[model samples]
Target: MIKVLIVDDIPETRNHLTKLLSVDSEIDVAGTAGSGEEAIRVAMELRPDVIVMDINMPGMDGVAAAEIVSQRLPTSPIIMMSVHGEAEQLRRAIAAGAREFLVKPFSADEFSTTIKRVYERELGRREQLQAITPAPSGPQEPGSAEEDHQVVAVFSPKGGAGRTTIAANLALALMSETGGRVCLVDANLQFGDVGVLLNLNPKNRSILDAIEGGEPDADLLESVVVDHSTGIRVLLAPPSPEGADLVTPTYLRKIIDLLRVTHDWVVVDLPPALTDHTLGIMDAADQIVVLSALEITTIKNVRLFLEVADQLEYDRSKLRLVINRSDTAQGIRISDVEASIRRPVDGTVVSDGRLAVLAVNRGVPFVVSHPEAALSRDITRLARTLAGEPSTSASTEKPKKGLFARR
Candidate 1:
């Protein structure tokens, strides 16, 4: 059950809110506080799962108290309560570490839903982190940097087809299943957001520096990677936007070769525009996932990219299509998508705006925050499929049982 603390100076409001929340079986009102100071004391003492705090309490305002409570107990999610949903107050509440906002007139359903989401998000995060880090096999290659990793680059010819999201969630899924060393490289240097989405510190170390300083070995390259709470490592792009273009194809090739020797899986998120670096990454990839949407423009681009890959003698067998945002509500059907691309979409992510927005805004992966979501489930399945785990069903024209089909 989610332990909630109702923090408000007004007794009537506090009792009403507590009674409203008590109706939900999953929620438990730990206690009530009439002042911000009292709320802080309760939060520190009781360590509730969530705090429904009022904005205008005496001694300390809700925002200030939230900031203190949040610091004291970083694990608990704060939900700010306000008389009005004023834009400025809401902004302040968020900045003060409030995960969500509830207006004074919020219905029981609204309050309950927000509380449940916050609770689930936290619980899911803990589970995901636990899922990723397992015992190492033998000992890590000590001073043996070359024997450690496999770098897989994910590239597509088109943009707005969910490349970064794919790379981020795929990394999570891979790490969760394999419990091995997995690193995601945000090679889309200009607009790289893998770090931001994953809540990583944008450290100075990046692929650019490694490349510029000549082909560095695994020992030197290890300094650049940032390890997430979920155990996936990442080498972020440079903070400056203009710096991306400076990286040459030769530079990327060297980085991939080095990574392949060191990490278990090196997933790179290539930019939409095919530069020399993109081609080099594709050449080095064990698997290349081409992300496309069910749009005419994206389909046309996919066809063009396939032709280019054929001309360039890239592995057609390894190239796979992934259709993102595949909602039946959309006009574009799956048949139309396959007919245009001349290939079956490897997988489809279901429409989930709530999960997507929350994950992005909170800098957490959806698979980690809301694993039960359709998008998360599909992404996890895709990851398992890529890891050489056979699917239960096969795509043969004649029905055939896959390796793991029920017998």
Candidate 2:
């Protein structure tokens, strides 16, 4: 039987996961822990084949524990769990050697499938390792670092344009292509929803750590990431709402630059309102995904945003306009939408309320939940297009870069 350890600060979550795994005939729950400290002790003693860890824990967080466990037990695979949308945490988790990640409130089927996949992948790696006889056992130096990493920022001047949603799904889509490292940051600092969108617990060491310059070590990043089903990693917002202001624009750039060195793609979800931090992100971004819906207010905001970008002297080529929830039923034509924005719409993502609602409610990315769905397909195409491939797609229009007055 496959042995597993469940780690979460909350008893209910641990109990629920335990009960769910209990029904599996081939799996055994070797142990469980409520804190990061206890988890380390239990994990070392149990030495289970797999660990299901929650990123948010009191005193010692899950990422910290995973770092220790991965080093001590490189043979074992860790599957991280969380509800926040901070990108730093997700990148940190993968760096710590986690094999897979499961979002919170995951269905029984998702949970089981992930567990199975993790085991299979780990087992597969071991098989491959065994085939190579008598290889030198010293530390493997420079296991292929991610290079030419591009910074993509999803920003909107107006609220409710689905910038966060686009950034989240697009990051997952990028993962599908390269299987390289991807990081999504909820730079909406003050009112970020990347965490809520993924349903990760509020306690992530993302924006707070980046702002404070705490845990600057490369290994510390893994200790804070929440893993999603699609293998996309996330760094969630602060555990508390009040902690947002602590992050400044310089810190945001520093954090993004730090990630660029390690990650193949760094996607940031910026605040609807332009702050100093937003401008910093815009200046650093290799590509700017501007999201807007087909509404009068959204169009007007896009125009104003464009004006701001012009004022800031941001490159127009880097700005890619995306129209979210584009529907003819809304009495808006693509022609009129383009006429309003003056720039050609790079891509459009059709509205699928059913799919989107289900994805957000489950704290999962729609791209993973319904990869074959219309939205998911479009997202994949968009991902390719962002990577410099072409795709004839349809959605809303938003300005690229900050085209608004500097605050």
Candidate 3:
């Protein structure tokens, strides 16, 4: 039987929900509370299988209390009920660790079904996480280090340069090529596309979760980071645009440091502008793959950014210039880009408009869905080159000093 706790500010509503849930033979209304504070106290005592909560309450609001309950009794899933079905309300509830949301006038059947569904989903998520996490082996021995612990930041000076897309695909490609743990961090806090590209719709888990939870560490990261099908872990950006304000440069730098400790390749999809947050990521990365396109404006921005890199005292070898959609532009070719930037093009990704569209629409990286395509091959070659593998990549850099490989 699924033991449930119904929490609502209204006594009638709490009783009504109890009666509604009592209809299901498999559900047991073990407890009910009239306020958020009482709800947390009762929830802790009962430790029910699920907690159905009203979003608004006097004193401590449901979202606030739910956050506490979620941390204390993480195994017990929460279903938030709100009279208003606004997107912001739902987002708030989800960010507070709600597993499901129900509009105020939901039917008994819908409530019961939602309760069962959330329970099942949470169980499955826990099981999958257990399988992914290795057994605890205590502290590491002296001189021990994680192999393939490298940080690569995928950055661009201007927007619409396919920086996020490249970061996503490159992360997956790195995992496929090296058989290592690759984590894709969507550092574009305001408007991140990593989750959409990877088709990951996690529940209340983002980089914000780790930052807000306090000092960043591996244990904290494992809780917030979601796993991709191809064995790549992802630390997504905030759920809402305003939530980006909470993610600071210091938090981002710490996150990157902690991530590189456990992960083989930390591929950070940096924000477009040259901000403090982006600079922090650059400071952590072993290589900075600066993505540009074959457009005149894009090339101009790339040149200007390179001068900034020099001013920051960044070694030229630490940066690699990559041209996306290399053959699409009318007049500007790779050689022109190289000449304009006054640097050798380390890598190039050819465009396939139709396939790229299909991949994005389908929410799968082209490298994973269409590995045989020319686009996928280019990404794979680039991955190997960055991984320090001796491959015949079309890199025009010197043989001895090829594009700042980590290995």
Clashes of each: 8, 34, 0
Q: How high is the CA lDDT of each candidate model?
A: 0.75, 0.75, 0.81
1 versus 3: better lDDT goes to: 3
Worst 10 residues of 1 by lDDT: 391-400
User: Model 2: runs farther than 4 Å from truth?
Assistant: 4-36, 44-47, 50-147, 202-204, 213-219, 389-407
Q: List the residue pairs that clash in candidate 3.
A: none
Across residues 1-407, which tens digit of lDDT does each residue of candidate 3 receive? 99999999999898888888887999999999988899989998999999999999999889988887876577889999999999999999987778899998989999999999988987886675444333323222334355436788899988988888889889988776666677899999999988888766665789888976667767878788886654678999998899998987877888888887777788999988877788777866778899999888888999988988786656777788899998798887899888877889999999888988898887778887788899989988888788874222111221221122211
1-407 per-residue lDDT for model 2 (tens digits): 88899999999989999999888888898999999888889988999888999988888888888877775566679999988646787887876667776666788878877888898888886664343212322111246533456788898778888888889989977766655568888887667788778755433456676445543445566555555434456777776678876765656676777777767678899888776777777777878888888888888998998887787666787788888887633788778878887889888888888888899887667776677898888777778888763222110122233334442
Q: How would you encode candidate 1's per-residue C-alpha lDDT over 1-407 as one tens digit per residue?
A: 88999999999999999889878999999899999889889898999998899998877899988877765566788999898999999998887778899887989999999999998897886665675545543223355444334455676667767888889999888777666567888888787888678755433567666655666557667766666656677888877789877776666666767666666677889898765667667766767788877777887888888877676555555676778888843588988978877777777777777888899898888988778788999988888767763221111112222212312
- Where is model 2 poorest over a 10-residue stretch in terms of lDDT? 390-399
Ranked candidates, highest TM-score first: 2, 3, 1
TM-score of each: 0.63, 0.67, 0.63
What is the total number of backbone clashes in candidate 1?
8
Using lDDT as the measure, the top candidate is 3
